[model samples]
Target chain A: MTPFDTRGLKRRRFKDKIFTSIVWGLTFSCLLVVFIILFYIFKKGIGSINWALFTQGPKPVGELGGGISNAIVGSLMVVVVAALFAIPMGVSVGIYLADNRGKKWAERVAIAVDVLQGIPSIVIGIVIYIWIVKPVGSFSSLSGSVALAIMMLPPIIKNTEETLVLIPNTLKEASLGLGASYFKTTMKILLPTGIGGIFGGCIIGIARITGEVAPLLFTAFGNPAMVKSIFKPVDTVPKVIFAYASSPYDDWRRIAWGGSLILVVFIILLNAIIKLFERKWKVQF
Target chain B: MKNRWRILENKIFVRWLSISAILTMVLLLMFFLTLLVSSWPAIKANGFSFLWSKNWDPVNSHFGMLPFLIGTLITSFLALLISAPFSIAAALFLGEFYPKGVIPNIFRNVIDLLAAIPSVVYGFWGLYTIAPLISHLQQKMHLQASGLGIFTASIVLSIMLIPYSVSLIRQVISMTPTPLKEAAYALGSTRREVITKVIIPSNISGISAGFLLSLGRALGETMAVTILIGNAPELPHSIFSPSYTMASVIANEFTEAVDEIHTGSLIEIGLLLFVVTTIINLIGRLIIKRAIA
Candidate 1:
């Protein structure tokens, strides 16, 4: 028998061990980073999360305590308005893309959606500023919501299309066979079955735009005082954080941390809800 | 009568859906056209020099995108360089080493959470934590620095990019056929050998496409880069030098720009960013399609 090369075998084994260790080490480091960031955010922001942080408006400069009530209200207003605009349109387009998958126009629209998803938020801000804010002669929460609605469209559409695509064609065939119209088949059969995913997509879309500061930077314009009208400038949590965190005032910076904590908690809740929905509503067929 | 009413309703519904779908395309076109119209004055005045020139004096009415362009390219490429290896390793670990287990699921969730964290939050965190560390390191090295510079921005950007690239790579890696892997194992190959030789070699196209998609993402990231990049419009002379990316410059200047030419120039930069990102994303998407095919 030929002599076996024990040294070569040993070297290969050693190399494999080294590579595996490196992979595990790098992965653990990535996970460690997530923990570190979460830890720091919670630590820094936890103390500042109190009744006043959600109840009152911003205090004047150099003041010790104030809340982001204006920002909180503004965020809700803008995001809810954006959802109102985006959800219907996004779902409609999603349906169109899924129903007419192979058509030339549908393919073009799908590509456009993908490209739209890639456009930077700041650029969206600029376009919206030119299109809405400039023509209206003012920056308003309405304009901000419009920009955000645009940003929200791609994900909502993509998700709805994908979710609908996964549903068996038998459902649609059966619906049509029962003498239901295309509209009825879609509304009665397809949408309800996929509602969990569509709703999850809407929540994800909300989470995405909720923390967006760029498009709002130009369109919302960041009002410090409380705003009641959608046509007026409004403060959002992310915009407030951006303004406050960059400021030199220690008090404002504290408020910024408080705002960050709220934002993070909100996002985490949204994600958890998405996970829950995905698991609960997963259709077997 | 009921059948006729149903047909009418279906036609209306289908028509509305088609209109909505067409509006998505219209919106994209509007973005391009509005940017073109808003930036026309600068485009006309500066001509092609707007692209290659480095001069950006608002008072003198001179605006050029070269420095920011270079800054954007450098920071993005640097971020890709820093992130690619680590993300690849992490992906292999999760998708191959622990492909179906509690450990891999936890790791996957962590990575997804990484992507879910807001970019502004990342910027805020980096400004306080990573920026100070980089500043201290630079001072120790006797280099003039604020800790908020290209390198600092790239580091934070790389962290953000990792979730994206890792998810993409892990997806393609997991999709690597089981039979091929088993064949390598049957041939007395070590796991590392199976990965490096059989799996990676076959999935090279998908892997490259994943990285390309991440690079496209890195190019357009604004908030983290804006907060950490120090917003200097000058060309960076060193890795530690403060600089402006195309997106950051727009975010920093668009609201404050008072001059007509300045506003136009800023819009022009936005136009440039839109075009470049669209092209990169298209190429990445094309590559992904080809790889899948």
Candidate 2:
């Protein structure tokens, strides 16, 4: 080959090199920020997560004896309660949307679900506060869960509907061809196949609701101690973090960071669990 | 008779589930109506100036939202400005340039990981890490107040939105027919020509829609922004000036609002935000769908 083609090749190779460099630059830049944030949180917060932090309620602003045990438990209580109320309703709606006989109505329903999903989280919080809390005139865990449940609903419903619809048409036809009815075909053939996607949805929905602070603020009115009644004022990790981070007390601020870190890890773990479950489902279901 | 019963039972199940599905939509619509009606009281008092005023003082009877509204628009527009080009480039590389190997896998995981990070942690990062970076810039600029203002907040907000924009754009770009690119190459056109002329024109609407949708996200974002922006409320023209957004005001001042009008004003501010963001998203969806159609 002549030097003319060689020069052209060189130019192309040069451009390629520049492009790869940019890509690598972007990848490392993103990782650098993410890792730095995670490390800073761990460095600032993890040391304080001792038995006292978990067992005691709240320490005097400086010395450390009391823990955020109550808030942690309270956070779990609301999240669990919200999940309990939201999942069944969301899943049922998802199933209906996915398995409906009327295609036109299904599309309309899908549009509505999308609109609901787009509504801001704080708006949902305010609406729930008005509908549930104002009537009762108290901030309670139930009210908090209700708000969170509504927040959690749209994702699960949308994901479940989408995942179920993605099932191979042949699978459904096969079940029906083998004398199975529409309901049986869906319950067994469609849903089982979509369980992985549904699980992914569930994980994300839970993660979303767990980090939510604005909604919980109006609904739960942060309590200092672990309250047993679901209808009583409750503390959540996010609420604690928000309240304590801005507080005048240094100890409260440290605990707030610690709480924030715990939430970050929990979210990361849940994501990993969803991926791992998806992988396993790719094998079995 | 038994066969007839079996057919009827199956139909009933189908009917019931469809009804349930329809019900979810109906209920959600009802909830939206409730929100509009419930907030009408606040809306009536504030009038349309609910959006134009900036003074958010609660002690005095003065209620201005121009600052928060401007703040929301400024931060969102800034985020779109910063994130759009990078996301488009990254998406192009992922869709066109990158060999399907470790790099793409890493990129995919990074994108997913970015979305997975909690917003609160993003807030903390803005506060501890990013804010310090801004403070350094402020010193360099010889500014008295910290330069951790709207611009710094916008940077953080942009970082937060890149993942959503990138993946969605990548998906749209990948859906383009390959032959168009092949034809461009066959005509002795370059990769840049193929992308800028062929792929982009085909998917311009989706690309723009993606940016606008993420802008909507930026408008609603509170946690990260609240930490970075110096939360001073006023009608400042410079990005370096500290400001408050509609959302941060709702989050920060909702409880501390002293009286009934103060609380109502805050709610009025939120309603304005909700209306703006919802309209942006709705228009985006319609535009993108129209493009595809």
Candidate 3:
């Protein structure tokens, strides 16, 4: 029997050790950056929170000790309104894409959806501003919602399509075989079966729009006071945070940190809820 | 007669539902139409010079997109360059190095949470934390810096993209045929050797797709870039110099612009950004399709 090449094996071992260590180091550093950023945001933001931080509208430039109550409300309004528009359309599109699979129109719609997702949030704001703001002759919450709805569409569509795709074709076919009309089958069987996943998508969409500030730039335009109505200007958490963060005042900066903290906490909560629901109510084939 | 009536009802309902599906395409068409119409004034006035001209003067009525365009390219490419290695390594760690268990699942969850954190938060973090660090580095290196510039923006963008590209690359790496890796192992290959010689080369297309997807995202990224990019319209003299992206310019100026021409010019930049990102995404999809096939 030939002797094994111990030198070659040693070299290979050394090389493997070096490469593995490098990869592990890279992974550690990447995770460390995430932790550090999370830690830093929480550290800065947590200290700035208080009862006043969530109760009152912003104070004037010279004043101190105010909250972004208006922004909080405005964010809820915009996101809820956006969800109303996006959910139905997104789900419908997703259903169409999944049901039609290889059809030419389905392919086209899929491509369009991908392109829509690629469009910048700022560009969507511009388009929606031209569509709604120019016609209305003012920045309004409705315009902001429309822009966010556009932003929300791709995720909902993608997630819904993915979830629906996972459902066995037999379930759909069996429903059709039972003399249920296409719409009825979709409404009763398909959507219900995919509800958990679709709801998860909706949550993701809402979370996505909640922190968006770019698309609201000209559409919602930040309001210092409370939102008067959907037809008027409004403040959102991210917008408020952005405006305040860039300002020269130390108080505003502190408020920005507080707002950041709240926004981050909200997102973290949403993610946790989604994860919990996914674990509890995952749809099985 | 009763059966015919019921069939007609089904047909109508199906057709109606189908319209909603077709509306996705309609929405895309409308988006493009509005962007084109809004951008027409600037397109007509500036002609081809709008693309190449460096001056973006609202006072003089000249709106050149070249600087911001270059800025966007610089930052996106720089982000990809900096983050791609780390993302590949991270993906390799998850897909190859670690066993599928609690520790890897925890790491995956952390990455997902990182991705879910909003861009504005990244922007805020950039403004407060990263920019200062960048400026400190600038001071140490004896270079002019504002901490808010291309370098800082690219750094923030790289961080934002790491989670994205890592998840995508990890998916691709995991999808690689297990038999190929097994074959490599049977040949007395080590884990690192298997990954390098068998896994990555075979999944190169998917890895490239991941990179392109992240690039497309980095191009359109608004809040993070706006907060860190310094938003100067000047052509970037150095990575440390303040610059603007097409998205940031539109975000910063769209609300406050005084003229139709100004708005039109901003919309033109939006059009440019839209076209660029669309092309990038299309290419990414094509590559991904091939990879999957």
Q: lDDT winner between 2 and 3, please give it.
A: 3
lDDT of 3 by residue, B1-293 (tens): 97888789878767865897778779878878889998898899989989899999998888888999999999999999999889999999898788499998888788777787788889888998889999998999898757999999999899999988998888888888888988999999988889888899999999999899999999999999998999999999899989999889988888779888988999988888888888989888878777766
Report RMSD (Å) for each prediction in the order shown. Answer: 1.4, 3.2, 1.9
Every candidate's lDDT: 0.90, 0.77, 0.88
Clashes per model (N, Cα, C within 3 A): 0, 7, 0
lDDT of 1: 0.90
| lDDT tens per residue, model 2, B23-116 | 7777666665766676676667667776676666676767778888788788889888987767887777676677378878677666666676
lDDT of 3 at A123: 81
**What C-alpha lDDT, on a 0 to 100 scale, does residue B108 get in candidate 2?**
67
What's the lDDT for residue B181 in model 3? 88
**What shift in Å separates residue A46 of candidate 1 from its native position after superposition?**
0.3
Clashing pairs in 2: A53-A67, A56-A67, B53-B64, B53-B65, B53-B66, B54-B66, B54-B67
Q: Give candidate 2 misplaced runs (Cα > 4 Å).
A: A1-20, A173-181, A282-285, B1-16, B287-293
CAPRI class of candidate 2:
acceptable
- TM-scores of chain B, in order: 0.96, 0.89, 0.94
